[model samples]
Target: MQIGIIGAGGMAAYHAKGFTLAGAEVVGIADPNKPRSEAFAATHAIPATYRTLKEMKTQHPNLDAVSIVTPNKFHASLTIEALQMGLHVYCEKPPARNASEMQAMYDESKRAGKLLMFGFNNRMRPESRAIATYIEQGEVGRINSAQATWIRRAGIPGFGGWFTDKELAGGGPVIDLLHMIDLALYFMGYPEPNCVLASTFHDFMGNASFKGPWGIADGTGKMDVETACHAMVTFKSGQCLTIRNSWAEMNEREVVSTTFQGTKAGGKVERLFGIDGVDETSVDSAVLYTEEYGRQVNRTIITEKDETMGRIANAMNFVKCLMEGEKPANTPEEALILMRITDAIYKSSETGTCVML
Candidate 1:
């Protein structure tokens, strides 16, 4: 598989490495910033760099796929364009700025008959994979409810940059840190949501004290996104999901977790970060709760720690799916559903009423 990278950002490097590791040739890299593209190409030993995907395609016509690591606003447009050009797409998360855009991307992918996968990396983690196996085996049967949270203490990224700008990055932590929500939905079989009731807060929106250590460049743009979002979603199947996400909030440490209650048992997969985005200071755990022999039982699941938190692995899966005909880890259909839920959350927050799906 010949791959081209769409952005010259930090995530583009990760995809380049993952594609290379998966035995795929990275033909070129593209970014509007020539210097950044050139730097990224040089670092990855890519043979070419272009200012746009069209230029990359014109130069490397044999490119089989492209990885999009650009901003949230570009996800739908780029994915649709790549699919229209007869190339598969591996897009970074949030799917798109809104559900309608996500739907358009999905429709185009289907019309183009090309694979369209999104970056839901949390589902690729070792512990998550293990828990999924247990779920499949009925260890955790018929998940009735779940709680998904990605809360941070003073961890807002680029306070005034695209990340905090509602138009650029969609919403704040609710969208940026939606991995847990997607993971929980995946665990619960992606039931159709009935409605959502959400509340968003902007208490620490422009506070520099909440800036994270990600080193993302700060922008002088409007910081209109929320600092925190809490919501509850009810599914038509009577299952429930509660979400809590925040870029900055009162918390002891950064907590990223998903807990599910099932008819047969219950389980949790979590990462406790001493410092946000610093893998060396993170601890991971997966545990299953059950009853055996009329006694309460708790079993800890042990798996190798993924310092990258499945980012690289998720990219590698995209490569394998294209090259080896393996099923993709995620699909655009799932992404559209996630995006619809996200849209409802934002709408509900704005209207102060339950938004029905």
Candidate 2:
């Protein structure tokens, strides 16, 4: 299927890189910024470029799928448009800002009779996929409890950029932290989450410690929503999980780890340790631990590949699902559940009470 990407952002670049690696043709990219769009096209050698998504759709009626990599606010609208245009969509995570929007996207896809895949790429990551296998293999007897973190140190995203503006961003670390939340939910077999307790803060919005290269414009930074986020979430299948995430931090690394503690086997599926690096040298090392004969056994680190391995793997997964007329692992419905949990966490933090699902 000919893929037309709908953004010129870094995530767009990642998908293009992956698709190219997977031997998929990226014929066009629709971006508002001509320079950014041209830059992306030049970098990826795309044959066609348009000023907007609608224009791209009009020009490329034969396009089969679109990869939506726009900001949080545009996900649903762009996805709905693509579905209406008779194109399957593979959108990035936190599929929509809230359940209402997500459900609407799902409904549109259902009516269109097309596939809508959420870009939960970690579903195709090596260690993440392996750990899920381990759990099913009874390496972890029964995952009763789990704890994960996406905390950052000195990690405030572009201080005055869209990331700090809740209107543009939807939320702070909550959305950024959702990769872990979704992964943990996937690890837990995606049981129905029963309730959520959460706490959010704007305390670090003005903290200069978080201002590294991205200097704040004024004494007060433009920070809406929670700077630091924490959530206590429960699932109906007797599974409970704790999540910690922050984009505003003092140090530079992304997060600590996802410590998988279950009834039997346990490990960490991290970008560094557990995550097998399929990209260049920087991403190959991962944090992984396995328990064997009562001994905590750390497994051998995964190797890195030179190609657009990770993203292409994800693209192939989506293509295979589309070819077989089946939903990919990261379907819109599954992504909606994750987004709902994310929304509930934010709501719970605001009310300072447990939110019922």
Candidate 3:
């Protein structure tokens, strides 16, 4: 497979590496920043670089697919364009800025008969996949509710950049942490959200002391997005999902946890990442609790140590799907649902009322 990358940021580099590891030739890299594109191309040994997707398509006509690793606001337009140009797309998560854009992208993919997979690489984790399979096999029975959280003590990413800008990034942790949110929903079988009640806060907008693992803060740019968001989404299946995410918080440590309650058994997956960030194999575990043979049993499963490996697996799966005429596990339809829920979260937070899906 000949693949092209649509952005020259950290994620684009990571995806290019993954595609290369998956036996795909990264033919070109395109970014608005010419220097960044050139640097990424040089580092990856890609033969082509472009200042825009148009140039990339014009230059690399043989490219089989392209990964949209750009900002949230650009996802829809780029994805639609790629699909229209007869190219498959592996879009970065959060789908788009809102549901409407996501739907359009999805519709384009359907019309084009091309693959459109979201970059929810966490779901490709061994532990997460194991849990999902276990639940699907009826081990956990019918799920009732779930709590999904990814909170940090002081981890505002790329402060004053597009990450903190509402126009570019969409929202705060609500958009930023969509991977974890999608994981929770995936475990719940991608239930249709009936309504959402949410609250958002911007307590640490311009705080110079808090910085995450990416981007440099310039101190003069505005942080016009939320830093924290809490939302309760009720699904049509009567399953409730509670999501809590914050880039900056008054806490001791960063935590990633997802707990699910089901009719037959209950399970939880937890990971702790300190000041830097989480590693692939760092402090991750999944445990299930249930009664068997008149005895309580707790089964613990160890997740893969490195997230990068899972990303490689996901990239491989996407390439395999393209080669074998198989559909990807993370389809744009489910991504559309996720985006709808995300959009409702923002609306509900703004109105202080439940937003019906």
Candidate 1 residue pairs that clash: none
**Consecutive 10-residue window with the lowest summed lDDT within model 2:** 273-282
Predicted structure with the largest lDDT when compared to the true one: 1
| Lowest-sum lDDT 10-residue window in model 3 | 213-222
lDDT of 2 by residue, 1-357 (tens): 688999887678777866666556788999988988998899889998898778987888788888988878899999998899888888876688888899999999999998888777766666677667777787677677778787766666666676777776688888865777777878778888899999986767756666434342332335676778878988887789998887664434654456667766566766542222112333433444567788888775464432332555776666667665544777776777887888898889879899999
lDDT of 3 at 181: 85
User: What are the per-residue Cα lDDT tens digits for candidate 1 across 110-205?
Assistant: 899998998899999999999999999988889999999999888888867889888889889989999999999999999999999999998887
Residue pairs with backbone atoms closer than 3 Å in model 3 (clashes) = 280-305, 280-306, 280-307, 281-305, 281-306
Pitting candidate 1 against candidate 3, the one with the higher TM-score is: 1
Residue 239 CA displacement from its true place in model 1, Å: 0.5
The TM-score of predicted model 2 comes to: 0.88
Q: TM-score for each prediction? A: 0.98, 0.88, 0.95
Give the better candidate number (2 or 3) by lDDT.
3
Q: Rank the candidates by lDDT, best first.
A: 1, 3, 2
Q: How far out, in Å, is residue 8 in model 1?
A: 1.0
Q: Which ten residues in a row have the lowest lDDT in candidate 1?
A: 273-282
